[model samples]
Target: MDKIERIEIAVIGAGLGGAAAAALLDDAGFVAHTFEQAPGFDRLGAGIHIGPNVMKVFRQIGLEDELARIGSHPSHWFSRDGTTGEYLSEIPLGDYALKEYGAPYITIHRGDMHATQIARLDKSRLHFGFRLSDIVEQDDGVLLTFENGRKVLAGLVIGADGINSVIREKLLGAERPRFSGWIGHRALVDMNKLRSTGLDYERCVKWWWEQSRHIMAYATKSDGSEYYYVTGVPVDSWEHSESFVDSSREEMDAIFGGSHPMVQGLIDATESVTKWPFWNRDPMGLWSRGRLVMLGDACHPMRPHMAQGAGMAIEDAAVLTRCLTMTGVQDYATAFQLYENTRRARATKVQTISNANTWLKDPEDPAWVYAYDPMNVELN
Candidate 1:
């Protein structure tokens, strides 16, 4: 495919979502550029699930093989009792997803997925150390100002920045994301360490549901390591900041140190933990205004209970590329509207369902979520 020389798209915040959107745009022969706030490695922490809905998008973008190499398909999803470590229910994902959804339910480190998309994105199109400060709409396009006193212009802007999005604030109004009143504790255990305690590292994605909190553990990558996440009540009620805070093993011990041995042992083995409060934003009444639009967390951030964050952003990129198949600014408006119409309800449903069932979802959710394909779908 010949590259389109004239700039058409400007992606704000070169995280996984932004980078994936840029790559898909480039694949569509559009001149798409990206500006990122931080240097490399800004999103180096945490882990995420790459479900079939995500893989379906990746399959369309020609990167499923790489994702497969970096991630492993979970055999099943097991819901267990946090206090007793007894199974509550289970659903097969490894073979079932492949057979039903034409993709795998893989789990990988969030950083790995981000890095994969970044590698696929054209480096010449990426501008680093460019934090977005403001967006000024113009007759032909939008003028974006960066904190570094630089300006760039493109026919349209896509905000793939995370929950705290400056583009969203400028495009819409400033809005606060709601906290779920649970502090998240996350850590990665090397396969060696997991084996040291005979932990099941690759059997399934395990969820230990308690009253108001839960523990989720799964294999992060093929490198013989496990990624574990535990949700617990905050030590203090004074509204805790949602930023990830470095915490000690001792501090975590005060929370889950004495649960069932598997849960407690997992906490005890964690060398360090970064605790953060889970926060999510409700879907906006509108996702686009004129030439500016939003995607991923900027548009629809949901709880990790459903593990669709990365997949949703990638789906946004793929669908945006498909919708923005023309050159004119008028085409951008149509594309933006079509993108939002196609995505808003689906993303909102995931947000609502995940929030409703924090640790479990309806049996129909897997089919509704995993069997989705962005490429061949009709827009709402």
Candidate 2:
């Protein structure tokens, strides 16, 4: 009879952060298992941008070529006026990222990226429908109790369950997700349907921004077959949570009512749209609580103005693995402290800036964000 190896790390949640954390730890010689509340693997709601910062992590982990093949590579990020479509500013992304940051700015559907990483993991180690109930710290490890009444003993716990995380509330006390008074409507449209509008669908990521409202569209597939679009507008109040039932065209029109023709055409091309009320968290000085530590949205959920919620999580996972490797997993106190030391400042800064500037503004210089490398960065 074969002996089953005990999991050394328990990663709560199977979203991007949780799955990626498990993959990174497993690659670094840790027996990590991901526990997800969902019974089966599925796609999250929208498309996502992978900045150079996060791409470098994928490059080092040997998924760069695979990512490049499946995702869209945009040459620039173009900002324009929402009503007039006048160019405000431009930033290089595609080759710029490859040459300067050693990676490419890739965009892909959320499901594709999650599935790619999940496929690399040992399926036997993944447990679904194990909703977290409570975590009890022990001298040797931590005991995790799931709502299903199953208990698991793991040497370490990573809280990557995302916003409204059960682990964070249990470990750090209850924290509510602060709504940003913003409603985000997102859709994926066929590029061919939008090509007749005469907008340069392949030129750059076209962002149309107006006061209190903005919209952006980009090609999401390599062959320019589909475009990912998101429109953000301020609401007086947001009682609705995130959902994706079919919306009336009148409702869609009301969101971006007076947008430019180019923007409207993109909207018209969209057949389905999902809306999610933007939510974020206040800055935390630290996210470590003894043997348990938090990462991603579970720790620092930020506004989407920066398009970096996933980037920060991936960076956190990489730096955390490095910290554990350096401090030795037995000394989790030192490891978690080191991880927080390296991540807290960066995460807080992104959260602050993303919240303060909730619209896509042309950066005076974006290298501060795009050029950062977690591997080479010093632990502040």
Candidate 3:
């Protein structure tokens, strides 16, 4: 048996949600440690929209200004017809988001934002290359066994480990996430090639087609140096064993060719592209069991259509931290209950709409989502 180390809180999976949870918990004066499986991270080719809702949380953690400085502040989230370039809707952002939603909305490189999050964490408490392999719940605490021959007894555990969370499996049993019949092709376009078309691409836009197939494109930087896009296409099934597979410009043309000039320009700019299958799980009946609890994708995995998946996870981190602060680690059950009460309905609503892929497809008020202040919201 490995020597049993002890900790107050153990947060598994240092992804967006896990990192946020660890940060918020530490800020609230809790001794929390974050464990990640990967030895390190890479600057992957992907983009994410950070809604004002989540920016508020980032503000609480003191990262709002740095992120705002690094990310692109689009004037609006434009939805347009893929073939005709006809405007379907233009939802206000930029200054409008700052004034109305209590924070700024920005589209940024997912890797850049993630690196920023990881950088802000306490170095001593953040552990890399620690893959969680087994969990044992006890009366006073929980035992965590990592594959690296490390053992830890944590008073409380937060499973921000994502959809395939080992902690989640311990609670709900071993089951694979169901494929949502959707795959997204992600790519970062060659900026020079894109500019050669001489057509101005909006800072943030979603090109829509029939059957809900579309590409969400936006700049990842404030200076517009990096542009990225992710496409959602329905498929019969995902047979590939790898998480993602390579795709080519010809494949893109075959699927979205002869559309609008701008759409054609994007294909021409595509140098390297990869396609990934989206996996999902239904709304869980259990968000926590004893000292083990879950947040983000572990509790409510959804499609990324709404662009609020990470936002929800970060929000969960904030709220969970608040709950723990209220009840203290000794009363973890009450804290867990409050966390679920505060998060469930909202998370479920977002999950439902995200799976439908209808958010922001038409002009409508997004205040309910973008305006929510998780840091100050009343805990149930």
Note the residue pairs that clash in candidate 3: none
User: lDDT by residue for model 1 over 1-380, one digit each (tens)?
Assistant: 22223357889988878888887788878888898988777445577888787787777778889988888678998888878877777778988889998888888888888878788878899988989897888887887777888777678889998889887898778887777665677887666766676665665788877655677888777654656565545444426454777877787677666677777767757877787777767667878888889998898877767777767888888787788874244577778878888888888888776656553532334688888888777765
* TM accuracy, model 2: 0.94
What are the lDDT scores of the predictions, listed in order? 0.77, 0.81, 0.90
Q: For candidate 1, what's the RMSD?
A: 3.6
Question: Candidate 2: worst 10 consecutive residues by lDDT?
Answer: 240-249
Error of 2 at 268 (Å): 1.5
Which TM-score value belongs to model 1?
0.92
**Per-residue alpha-carbon lDDT of candidate 3 for residues 1-380, written as tens digits (9 for 90 to 100):** 57899999999999999999989999999999999999988998899999999999999999999999999899888888888888887789989999999999999999999999999999999999999999998977899999999999999999999989998999999999999999999998756778987755566656565445888788888888778888998899999999999999998888888887787888888899999999988899999999999999998999998899999999999999999999988998899999999999999999999988888778878999999999999999
Report the error of model 3 at residue 277, Å.
0.4
Cα deviation at 344, candidate 3, in Å, is: 0.3
The positional error of residue 87 in candidate 1, measured at the CA in angstroms, is 2.1
Structural similarity to truth (TM-score) of each candidate: 0.92, 0.94, 0.98
**Models sorted by TM-score, best on top:** 3, 2, 1
Cα error, candidate 3, residue 356 (Å): 0.9
- Worst lDDT window (10 residues) for model 3? 203-212
> Relative to the unseen true structure, what is the C-alpha lDDT of residue 22 in candidate 1, on a scale of 0 to 100?
87
Cα RMSD of all models vs. native, in order, equals 3.6, 2.6, 1.0
What lDDT would candidate 2 get against the real structure? 0.81
Best by lDDT: 3
